[model samples]
Target: MSRRRRKALPSEPVRCVIETLSHDGRGIARDNGKAQFVDGALPGETVMAKFTSTRSKFDELRAVEVLEADDARMTPPCDFADLCGGCSLQHMSGESQIRFKEDTLREHFAHFGGIEPDEWVAPMRSPALGYRRKARLGVKYVPARESVLVGFREKRNSFLTDIDRCVVLDPRIGDRITPLRELLHGMDAYRRIPQVEVACGDDSAAMIFRNMDPLSDSDRQSLIDFGQAHDLHIYLQPKGPDTVHRIWPETGEERLSYDMEEFDLTMKFHPMDFTQVNVDINRNMVHRAVEWLDIQPGERVLDLFCGLGNFTLPLARSAGQVVGVEGDDAMVVRGRENAELNGLSNVAFHGADLQADFTAQPWAAEGFDKILIDPPRSGAQEVCEYLTAFGAKRIVYVSCNPATLARDAGVMVRNGYRLVRAGVMDMFPHTTHVESMAMFERVDN
Candidate 1:
């Protein structure tokens, strides 16, 4: 038997009117009762789309020309927005982007959780451009072009986009992409380098190069010179993550820090550690979470999925004691280190598998007055099952994914809590990724 060959895409462009937006920022249209997802198109727009792939249930296409534009549509700021996969909703205005995210969250709650909050808070907004502080850029050397490409992958493809600069990235690193390409092209290990991870803090930025082979002295010196000239800390990973070591500034601490002026605190972390990509939005998020929790001086607060004391230390300033729990022990250690650096002895860090039963643990013996949860994209379904055991009066949940948040919100409602207020956060301005927050209060409390 032979495998069936895939159907060929239509050679001519098809005209369609976009009815709505998909969760991933694609425009949805119907053609002969079948759905079509068109990239770079907005809802309420008429476009001529070229089919890229065909499927039985639905088809995929890219919008070649917009015949009619939506009121929310705007010209993308990035020159390579159409080619780069890093951002998806750049054509939509920032205000419209926030509205789309809010709508997405509302639909998730209504469909998955079968519920809605009593009140919806205002969406937290951030700078529409130059807000991204963390990114992993692809590096490839093309001999035909006699140059190297350093940027994100092309939309819907594995090939790197031929971009000179990224407007969304922090200008410190985004502005240097062309120079970076030139510098890498001159290196003997240009072909051996696969990617570069960039991270920026308030005062400094760092880049870690993933090198397949050991660099020669000349290549190493070249990297050092680039770092020194650009004021970037450089690290090279020859084999594995554990082998990453800093080469430039060869002396002091191997860390970058961002200041939380609201709490009069500074958060220090390694370049590889997990940190929020948008610093302004993160600061606003932290402030809002703390304010919503309404921590009192005599109360004890519990922070779940805490990483590096982002919320724990801030709560400690108001609460009598704050206990933070995380799955990664390294992050637990980092939390403790941050606590010590802040000179706060009221906060304690613990490492535990949050998905498992930890009710017997000593920390769980005493009930908490308030709770703050900042779970990952997977959400905290298992942890939601045990929230009643802690008997916290108020629970604040910060979520990166709205679907999981809705699912967990239903669990909280079923467990004798009511969804009081929920809202969205514009963390990634040009992406469909929805960052949200909700306030839950015990029915009897």
Candidate 2:
């Protein structure tokens, strides 16, 4: 079969006025009845954009120069903001970014769910910069430059962006990008290392280097030295996720922890475990989820898609009993460990395929009085189908994707629940990713 050739982009930059912003933070403009997605441009701004890609329905462009800027436009904090894919809305003010996210969520609810919340809660906010506690940084050795690049990929490209520091990441690892590049460049197996996973706790930080090949003894020692000097834990992944092991501070426990002061709980997790990237937002989110659920004393609660008992442990503190269900058995084990560590005997952890019919499970026999769900980007349509069967009076849903959440919310509404309130949370700021929460109450039909 003959392959179709891609249409060549125009050589000259075209001038246009941005009419609106897309969900992914791109500016939408129309030229000759065709839509164009303009990167690095804001709504209501006029720009000269160079065409990067041409498609059948629309074209993709990168704004070369802003002829007129929006009031919300400001200087980006990161030097590589225009090139790095780490953050997309750095040019927009923090308030405007929140508004955009809220508006996106509102649109999703109205379009996908065919419903809206009775009241829109105030958007949950946090520090705009230096809040990222986790990231996977790309590592590449450039022979042409005689240096190693350690940062995010370039916008719309797989190539690593040439950056020295990150403004939004936790300073522990973000500020050390240049030093990390230097250290990797000195290593004998510099080219063998592909990426570094960064995980930061309240008191400590860790870096897991994914080595494609065996590291030399000198290279390993240098990594340890760097960790010791910077007070960062060093881990190495030789093959797979199970192969990740700590190398530095060989004496202490191989775990990092964060404290939920309101609940008086300290959650311990492995460096490779799934965790929220923004700690402040997570803490606030947990608090709001618990408060919104309104778990009365002696009432049973259920937490679905629970990881490491982040909400289950806290919910147990208030409810008579709390059950946490997760798909990953490893996370179930971690949840049990967290429950034990917190001395909460009222909670239990169960592992099950949440996408399937879990109503027949042993834990599901006893109906829950309240429920809390923190699903991933795909959302929980399967579980939402049988949500009201549990007879929960109130439910709180924490979502990372608005479209999926809206779709699932419609399912819940059809199952005899009313959308009470909903709002966006700035879990990931300066990025198009929207984290939101919605409350639902069972109607007494």
TM-score of each: 0.98, 0.98
Number of clashing pairs per prediction, in order: 0, 0
The collision pairs in model 2 are: none
Task: Go through the candidates in order and give the C-alpha RMSD of each one to the true structure.
Answer: 1.0, 1.2
Stretches off by above 4 angstroms in model 1 are: 1-3
- Candidate 1 local lDDT, 68-114, one digit each (tens): 99999999999999989999999999889999999999999999758
- Following a full C-alpha superposition, what root-mean-square deviation does model 1 have from the true structure? 1.0
Following a full C-alpha superposition, what root-mean-square deviation does model 2 have from the true structure? 1.2
Across residues 336-387, which tens digit of lDDT does each residue of candidate 2 receive?
Answer: 9999998999999999999998887899899899999999899999999977
Question: How does candidate 1 fare on TM-score?
Answer: 0.98
- Where is model 2 more than 4 Å wrong at Cα? 1-6
- Model 2 / residue 152 / CA error / Å: 0.4
Ten-residue region with minimum lDDT total, candidate 1? 358-367
